[model samples]
Target: MPEHSRQALSDYAVAHTTKPDSIFDDIARDAQTTPSAGMMSGRTVGYFLNTLVAITGAQRVLEIGTFVGYSALMMATALPEDGELITLDVSEEFTSIARKHWARHPDGHKIKLILGPATETLDTLEPQFDVVFIDADKDNYPEYYEKSLNLLSPKGIIVVDNVFQGGRVLQQDVPDDQRSASTRAVQRLNEIVQNDERVNNVMITERDGLLLIRRRDAHLA
Candidate 1:
């Protein structure tokens, strides 16, 4: 792709994909008031996540980050009537906005928010979730991935957001010890997932990047 067309390509792709309904617009509008508004997962990832739930027929889902609930609601829409999603976040302030919007939709009942540090919250969760999404603090990516892997059901998929770390990992490789903490964790995650004999993976380059992984020989314990 030409340099000029790079951004245009992304716009074109998002335009062609399933457009989010007006409720998402409302959520986005509310989130815009915050400094970290940019962290809200946009329609590209949200739409893809929705589709993943639909196709996988996932009955239960786990999300490590719930930024204003954009992605959580997207996945919830694709779930069956009896399905459920459990989302974790540390901020009541940010998630207060999420709660307002979740209540606006009928699928809101499908979502349950756990307000606490994700690492601690992960320890309390039982395994066998059909899908686990990690999108929280970059410095803890490796730890999150390890715990998420164990929480995932056999044949379940783990979808990691921001794995590219805004193209930082694309630069010339550096010794792991020399990289910044956040960068090192993100890079190490990509490396570990790619080489792990226990799972198969693919990295999709769209809106940052998304890493999708699943066990090669799945067995839920």
Candidate 2:
């Protein structure tokens, strides 16, 4: 199938599930016009992030990727008045756009943008995130996943995006040129999650794919 067709299907699915908020729509517009636009996650993924934050009653959240900040806005809007979300992104330009959209909301103050490599940002954080969203560099996904789990509080959930790589994970004989470095890296992370004993996990085929992991508290071999 063509790439546009796949995106259409994904958009259709998301439309039926959740209404697009104004902040999300504005971010979509910014992404369309921006040079590095493709980094943004799909609306389906944003909806899932919103739902997960609300359902988990998460007050403190950590996001590994801000992109144009669609997902950050969605999750931040779900938080209570006292809730806060700290987001980390490496791109100064993209995050500048994110800050603009966030400023429009009354709860915008709840959103904090950390400009730096996510690994470095995660390292400095104190453990106790109610929810964690990982959607940054694919090559560092496993590292992000491990660190996110450690940062999560008891009963916290960690959501990892882009695990399916547009259904490429199941395909064999794909040309080396067509497969992305990130795709290969995500495939390895998928295996790690499947075998990990520290979390109860499930892979949902959303816009791309989402790995939902709830940290395990007990010691395991």
Candidate 3:
């Protein structure tokens, strides 16, 4: 095919692929807004999360960050009638909007939203989960991963979003500040996962990035 036509075809392919209804899109319809627009996870990442939920037949799911509940809604939609999802977020403002859309879905009742800082909220949970999704504060990536490991059952999956930190992980000259701290923390978590013996891992470059970790016995690895 010609160069321009080939480029056009590729663009079309990308656009025509399955796209999840994002919270941002919902906001556009409702004329609602948030500081970040809750545009964290992309369509590809959302679909991946949904597929994982369906594959594992996850009965219980824990989400660290419930930004507008986009990911939670996507996951809840895939859960069995009796399955449940516990989503935590500090932002009551955003969660309120998320609740609005979530309420519209028949399966929305499966989602239980907890408001408060995620770390504090997670501390109160029992050790029972089929899957846990970490997408909260980047600086706490390691903490979230460690906590999720304890919370997850054997064979359960722990999916971490934005592990790439917008490609800042590969950059040089990070200043000594919170931004630098978050970047450094994410780097440390990546190293931890790379050497972790308890989980099989794959880091995919979808949306920002996604780290899919499956907890299994050493023999299974």
Candidate 4:
């Protein structure tokens, strides 16, 4: 598809989707102006995450990355009154910005922001998350997947973001070693989820890419 056509379709999709409130709008504006704006999950993905939380009725959510807390805010709003969400991030600066917006929202108290290496933090968490969202460093995608699976409830769902890696995952030969490593990690994650017999998965092409995996069960069938 032509770039223009694709963008038009995306615009249409966003237009028809559930709109976010003013708080999310403000956070999005800040994220765009920030130096690490690209790290933030955009509005479309935010809405999708919100919808997942609603549809699954997820009481507990675990987010591997919380860049400025855009996705966290969205998911938190969709949760029930007593629902809880724990978001992990390594940067205090980014989480600080997130805390500002979260403090103003009514559901903000439901979110717990943890600052530090996600891998170490994941080790401390118990297996009770109903939904897990992984959007952290690309190089650790496989490790995140493993840890997320271990932390999930029996009927839990895991959402993996940036599976496309800005279309780099499709490239057979990436000359840059650093970029190659990141791309290879994403590729490996896709392969691992695809072949894992413990779960059933589907990859969606919505902005970048989102891989939704849930345990294979008779109830699901």
List the candidate 2 regions with Cα displacement exceeding 4 Å.
1-9, 171-179, 218-221
- Model 3 agreement with the true structure over 154-187: per-residue lDDT tens digits: 7788998888887787755666564578789888
Error of 3 at 110 (Å): 0.7
TM-score of 2: 0.89
Instruction: Please list the residue runs of candidate 3 whose C-alpha ends up more than 4 Å from where it truly belongs after superposition.
Output: 1-16, 19-24, 27-32, 172-179, 218-221
Show the colliding residue pairs in model 4. none
Please give the distance, in angstroms, between residue 104's alpha carbon in candidate 4 and its true position after superposition: 0.3
Q: In candidate 2, residue 115 scores what lDDT? A: 91
Q: Which stretches of candidate 4 lie over 4 Å from their true place?
A: 173-179, 218-221
118-162: candidate 2 lDDT, tens digit per residue: 888899998899899999989899899989988988888999988
Candidate 1, position 123, lDDT: 97
- Which is the better candidate, 1 or 3, if ranked by TM-score? 1
State in Å the error of residue 172, model 2.
5.5
Give each model's whole-structure lDDT. Answer: 0.91, 0.86, 0.80, 0.91
lDDT by residue (3-91, candidate 4, tens digit) is 78888998898898777889888898878767899898877899888888999899999999998999999999999999999999998
- Ten contiguous residues with the weakest lDDT in model 2: 212-221
Clashes of each: 0, 0, 0, 0
Displacement of the residue 55 alpha carbon in candidate 4, Å:
1.5
lDDT tens readout by residue for model 1, 93-195 = 9999999999989899999999999999999998879988899998898889999999888889999999878778865467766777877789889999988
